[model samples]
Target chain A: MNKNASRFLAGPYIIWMIGFTVIPLIMIILYCLTDGDGAFTLANVAAIATPEHRKALFLSLGLSLVSTLICLVMAYPLALILRKRNVGQGSFIVFIFILPMWMNFLLRTMAWQTLLEKNGVINGILSALHLPNLAIINTPWAIILGMVYNFLPFMVLPIYNVLIKIDDDVINAAQDLGASTAQTITKILIPLSLPGIISGINMVFVPALTTFVISNLLGGSKILLIGNVIEQEFTKGSNWHLGSGLSLVLMFFILVSMALMAKYDKEGEGTAF
Target chain B: MEHPLIDLVNISKTFDNTMVLDDLCLSVKENTFVTLLGPSGCGKTTPLRIIGGFEKPDTGKVIFDGQDITNLPPNKRQLNTVFQKYALFTHMTIAENIAFGLKIKNKPKAYIDDKIKYALKLVNLDGFENRSVASLSGGQQQRIAIARAIVNEPRVLLLDEPLGALDLKLRQDMQYELIRLKNELGITFIYVTHDQEEALTMSDTIVVMNQGYIQQMGSPEQIYNEPENAFVADFIGESNIVPGTMIRDELVEIFGARFACVDKGFGVNRPVDVVIRPEDIDLVEPEKGTLTGVCTHLIFKGVHYEMEVTTPDGFEWLVHSTDMCPVGKQVGIHVDPFDIQIMNKPESEDEEAVGVNE
Candidate 1:
């Protein structure tokens, strides 16, 4: 048998990418460049400078950046603990972290809304204890909370994978060479886990930037993020060209992050999880 | 009297219901090279880890210069380790790896640079300062690991099979290099390995272990010439060990023949084990020899010829000679009285068949 013949098994994946990914992206680009009557115009893309669109874009960037930073600060320590325990890859502890991923993401976000609402489970308990109500249900704080809760495992799993792959002898070697625990973490562990950190930042930031559903549920429909505006242009406004143009703008941010990831993680070792 | 530089006093360790170290004790002298020689899983590494502060014994204490340091962490200890795998930092250049200890101590820039240069020069890798650790070969990486450890000027250096990954030729060459390093640096070196030749060639003292127990600890000559039991005799080199009976002081009997021997102190008619080295047997004409046998097999070793001779009484003997004898040829074997060694059989299962010589 010809060994190379097995390569043709990738044919279906190539077709799937062309039909679902490549064609949709090319169609979005074409729609963004042409008006309804097939006339060339830059008006739709140029509309990003409008006050409302500009405010939405800056707010989206700020909130996502904050959420990504918080996730990093939270995930690195948890990954370290998991690796130190020498937990098996299929341990129940890892399953507990990944269990939330199996539940519908929307359901999890809605559960957070209930817990943060004035008359919901958390506030009911708080009122019984004479504590102040959590009024963050309809604020940007709730949206940021939802983003962090939903995307933390995305950060944890990849960083944990990288941490577990580090040889114990290397850590011992560092300590054997007179590096204190803090120095070892900063000089050896952090530098070695940089690929996972970069991948994690990309994973969290992109989704948190492009999410319209979390804001709609937790921040109320009144807060118009760039994702909300683009979604409205497609659904209510029936302005496909404007929607496609704004999507192209969002993609520019995603592409920039991707380039950053490529620079730090050339081998894609951190992207597996 | 001065205390030994490092002492492992009655240490014991167990992992998941299996005992790895059983009340082992060792005292290492200052500026001396000692080797822990054993087969894998024989608990040789546990002592090194206990000394390096990477492991804590379940019982007993580790004393350094008369100070109890059993609870100290690795970074706070005065010892350094060259791990089995070298464990060089892949993210850093060679220079940064060697300067890591000095940098942690906040040494001045000029001092750190001079030390880095000096350390690399000591390892004979003077110009590899900027290369990434991954770019170096296994031998180079091993040298860099040595440089990284020795730059700290630790009181004692622990090495856990550092030459395990090299080829035989390179391993031999590096053995001499390590001996030179130990002499020049004048630091106590505690090395671990299963290679008998390596332990014999470099170490001033060899500690032989088996099944979580020390079988013997002595100079290489003592370990080779006067093994305490049958296990030590069999593990050290090619030997012909046979069951014998001591008829009286300085007399023994084997193969139903009475032979005069230089060993004593065993009771009359006491059963014992006798060891004779292969090279110690001399080939002579059948009529002039002490015992006669027909050569059954012959092989030409690089330095000598090894032949298997079998007596008419069914005793098989291994002999090393400079000349070859044809198969089925009758040959006479002679032995000197001093060349025979008598030992008591091991009393327990833990100490069995564990000796080696170069």
Candidate 2:
């Protein structure tokens, strides 16, 4: 309970932050400012102006925005329905949503690839049904699907938490006031749940924007997102400067989204857990 | 009499295998305050919800203004409720909250503004239009809720214990405020509460309920003076209900002593419940009264002394008097014939238990 003991309890966390977070950020900035000869240069950061890099960054934005929108469209109704079911936490409905999260994220994305690939389970089902062959794999549609599938829970959970907390009396009062169901949802429910909506958008948009794994596994090498561009710079290209520069840019977007979250969700009422 | 503004005819409701309301019937006159008074879980709220269209009676019809609206949704009903907890929309402003019903009805902007202004003035919360709901206190929020409900000019306003959250002084003030508002608006008000004093003070007709059954319904004075049975007598006031026998017209036997009374519907030596209010008993010298007892305990109530006197027959009498009686003092109790209320004795312990659910 004493101040000195509490500070000591934070010793490990402080050390970990300084070593992993603070040091890595500083090193990334340092690497981003230097060239192969260790001389200061802006070429790596300036490479974002190039056509290929520009296309990748814009594609990343477009796809993530589409995925985030799709998640919102899907998650809000799902959350509303689940809340209306009135089953408390630890119910089977919630487990059905969270069960997939228990498996490894990579394994889930890879499983999606297996299902969507040509002559895969879905195509095989279509063929058995005597339907035409279907193909959406190795495209931006596949990448967006992967992002939405992986991050949909982040959207559902916060919205569901907020929806569950809204007092039944409030809804009843709305009805008693002669507001139709549609009017009540528009005027009362949506505005009250705005905090959760914004937070869910933040949760879904940030990771989907920066995800290399989903694009890599689902879209194959044909697609090059900002994340893929930065990733290849680090892995196959062996250019830490270029990769770190792009990560810094990605971190800027993350920081902006975090600031947006802070502005809208100051109380963290939308915190899913 | 003209047809009642609202009629709940033979209503019955069951919740998860438990009977909540059992064939209840009630009628409310226009422009009068009707209070559904009962303890919790006695189905007082179910009737209010049914009127507001938030609930449906399992059996029977809710006729509002001679039209059956039993299956209508709340939004389609021509009434509003001031919820028990003042369920104000926290996301809106005071003005916005009051304007909700009007806006939902698609009222014109100028008309809505005028109504909002009038509603706020009625609740004595003028100049609070721009204030957010979160910025107001509980009492103020409750006023806003009232303003919100009244703005739409519904035929009936169902208040489900609206003032139950306030302190005693504030509740008393709001009770008078509600009366004034009802008089000014000339709309029927259906109030629900378990507070007997509140019902006695504000209601034009009080329907006392116990275990989903209407124990009695009448004007406050009638209910206080002539209760139907032991349940109404005990629930309304702290009456000393003692078992006695009705010997004949204008006479009853209480604790081996014959007392003059005005009630005599029952003939012969029929058993009855003799209802005597605590404040009605006057203590005097032992030889000068009909019955005598020793003061067992004395509690100094704010304005009067509450003395518990135990008679020789072991029936403890609760007496409220101005003069203090010392503990263990022998006291004589006298009652006027008008104060002696008599009713048939409860048939069995099972029925009483089922009625009060004690």
Candidate 3:
């Protein structure tokens, strides 16, 4: 058989992408370009300039940025530890991180609500010990926590995968050349694993930026992210044009993030560590 | 009077349940190229790692320049390694890789730049400072690895089969390059390799090892000519290690023929192992020789003809000679008495056949 024959195997996925991704994307663009009467108007796209929409957009950006940073700060060291332990390819630690991802994402966020609620599992235990009762629920901090909880594996797997692939001999070479452990990590490990790091940032940041589900469950009704606003625009307000317009604005940020990823990771080799 | 530059005193290492180095002791002189030569799993690389501080021996002290440094980490040790795969930092440029040690020490930028240039120049990679390590060929990477280590101006250099990855031609060229680098650096080198030819060509002393024990350690010539046992003789070069008996002082026997030999000290009829190089045997008329044999096989080997001669008793000898003897032809096997090397029987083998030479 010709080796190119294997390319035919991707036929189903290509068709799926066209139907689910391409058509929906075209519809979104058309909706964003029109008003409710299907007449052309720039007002829906310009709605993002309003004070309420601007606050939601910046809030989404800042919160997600913080969440992505927390996930990175937490994941890189964990990945480094796993790599030092020679963990790769079906290690229990990797499986543990990936297990929560297999559970329903909304269910996992709701479970976190129970854990972080004022009179829930965590606070009940704290109060029994006469400690401070947990009250960060229905706040930006809770949403950030939920975002990190849901998306941490995305950051861990790639960084761990990349770190493990680095030859142990290279690390030994660094130490042999008079580099301390910290210097070796900074000079060799981080630079060598940059592809995975960028891929990880893209993975966690993009999803965290566009998520309305976590904020809805954890932030209650007070905080409004761009995603929550966009969700409300379509569902409760029955305004698909304004919703699609806001989604396009959100996509511009996603595209920029993706471009940043593509510039550093040309191989598209980032899926996991 | 000079003390040894590095002394590994009774070093022992074990991995899992197997002993990798069995109470090994080695002393390396300053400015000398010493090689740890053995087959894979014979614990050659382990000692080099121990010396480089990449491995800690389970027992014994690693004394360097009169200081016990068994507990020192690799970065604190005054030595560097040229790893087998040339472990250049893949992320760094050649100059950055070479300057890694200096940068860690917080050296002045000008001093670092000058050292990088000097190191690169020494490795003949002077203009390759900006080239990434991944861009270099295997040989170039090997040079960069050497340059990276030497840029630190370490007193000792540990090389763990650094040329094992290169092709034959490149490996040979790098052998000369390494010898030149070693002399130019004036550093004590603890080199590890299994290639006896490479060890012979470059090392001032060759330490032959087997089964995690030193079989013999000496000069290249001494190792080849005066192997302590059958294993060393067989490992260092091709040999016909047959069972024999030391008949008396300066006399021995093989294949029912008594030949005048130079070895003694074995009691009469004591079983021994006899070593004879293929080149030592000469072919002549059957009647005018000590023993007669028929040429069984012959093949021309570029520089000489390698032919197999079989005796009447089915004893086989691998002979390399300029004179090609045709198959099935009757020939005389002539060996000069001085060419005979007698060794003690290996401990593991049972004392059985003892052929006589007259």
Candidate 4:
């Protein structure tokens, strides 16, 4: 193929990307500078410095961080098991883990709400078994459980990709050289698969932070997060300026976190993908 | 009076209905080097893994220093393996890689430092301690692997084609270095390789295997000169096998001519396959030879000349000579009587006997 022809073929997507993504991002930055009275002012930016907005931002960050930790804890062993089993049922096993992803996001969230309700299947089973009835619906734990279920596959796949590619002989060599199983895992396997773990965490944390549907549906709208706050400003409050400012702040936080991750990945200078 | 450091008795392994190793038995005396030499899938590496405790034999006992470690995990076994790819911890530095085994044992810092220093020096990689392993050359990484395995001072060291990845010249150099290290460390080294020259160069004893069974086990000289069967003779080196009949004790007939060999105990007129190395067949002027042939091709191999000769009986023979012999020149081939190896012909009608009378 000629170079000119290839350039022509790439032109449309380049224009589309600049128009749809970059132009809108520039517009958002400009909007952050303008106030509700159509004047460029610091008041709109200063409004985001309020305690309620800061609390919501911190809550979102904390929730995302916790979700990432939980996902990592659950995903590492699942990835290890999938990598080590060496059976022909890998596809089936992966499907069982990922089957929840095929359903609509709202439906899955509603389903979790039904399952965690006060009179849901879980409480019904407890009552039938003559145990004290416990209420789990409309709680932070419910939100966490819902997030973990929705994002567990994303966490597992990347780690599994990295773990499966690790040379078995390397592990065997470690063992043969007198490394106990625990030492082998801590010293060899984990460090080698750090890139995968980081990628999996990013995949789980970024989406979990911006997810309001699961939290609102399962937490009974009592727990307000950054996503819920942004939603309220845009739809109910009709405060476009505040909503846009909060959106920019949320995006800034995500970008900063991602930049830190990228820096760590660079410093580690090991396999990432 | 000391017992062998490692002994495997009747070890066998079957994988999904395929016999990877069958009734394999080997014994390694303390501080001696033994090589498992065979083609790929001939159970050479399976035996090494079995010894290293990375694999378990279906029905066998692995004894290390008179202890039955058949059921022991690899970490508990007193053995370390240098895998074919080296399997160095790419995330660690050269020093860390060497100190890995010691660290696992929870050795003190001072002791690990000294051991790492000593092991690196043994492998001629002393100053390379802090360097990242990924930056080193392939040969250097291979030496690091050796250092890593030997730093623990295990009772046995298993090497699975550790030098197979190196170029020919580096591999040859490592072969001598390995022998020197073996002598210096006095640890039992169980080396595995498919390269015959490597086994012949480094091993005190060579075990030749094929199709999950040991074909022969002997010194390099014995394996090269007096292979027990056609498989060993063919596998160990280049050989010219001719179908012949044992006319009497120490005599065999080949291609309408009776020749004398050193082997005996075969009944008169019994069918046999005669094996002779190319170098053992002496060439002379065509008119004054026991086996006369016209040279069909000549390959100049630096130190020696290899010539293919077609004999009067249409048998092709390979003759190795240090002297110049032109193609199409008639030559006489004479093999030393004691150099001829005779074995029973393979029991197959489609099997063609290899003749080296080129």
lDDT tens string, model 1, A102-154? 99999999998788877989999999999888788878888899999999999
Clashes of 1: 6
* TM-score, every prediction: 0.96, 0.98, 0.96, 0.94
Off by over 4 Å in 3: A1-9, B348-358
> Judged by lDDT, which candidate is best?
2
The better candidate by lDDT, 1 or 4, is 1
- CA deviation > 4 Å runs, candidate 4: A1-3, A87-90, A119-134, A266-273, B346-358
Residue range A165-266, candidate 4, lDDT tens digits: 778999998998888888899999999888778778878888988888887898787888889988898799987777777888788778876776686566
CAPRI class of candidate 2: high
Model 2 over residues B144-243: C-alpha lDDT tens digits? 9999999989999999999899999999999999999999999999999999999999999999998888989999998999988888888888898998
Candidate closest to the true structure, highest TM-score: 2
Fraction of native Cα contacts kept in each candidate?
0.86, 0.91, 0.88, 0.88
Give the native contact fraction of candidate 1.
Answer: 0.86
Worst 10 residues of 4 chain A by lDDT: A264-273
Which regions of candidate 2 are displaced past 4 Å? B348-350, B354-358
Q: Candidate 3, residues B1-358: lDDT per residue as tens digits?
A: 6789999999999999998988999999899999999888789999998988888999999999999999999999999999999988877788888888999989999999999999888888779989987789999999999998988889999999999999999999999998998888788888999999999999999999877788899999989987778778888878777778788977888878877888879779888888888988888999987889999999999999999999887899989999889999999988888888888876553211111111
lDDT of 1 by residue, B1-358 (tens): 6569998899999999899998988999999999998878889998999999989999999999999999999999998999999999999999999999889989999999999999989989989999999899999999999999998899999999999999999999999999999999999999999888899899999998887888889999888877777666676677888888888888878787666779889888988888888998888899867789999999999899999999888988999999888899998888888888888765655444343333
How does candidate 2 score on lDDT? 0.91
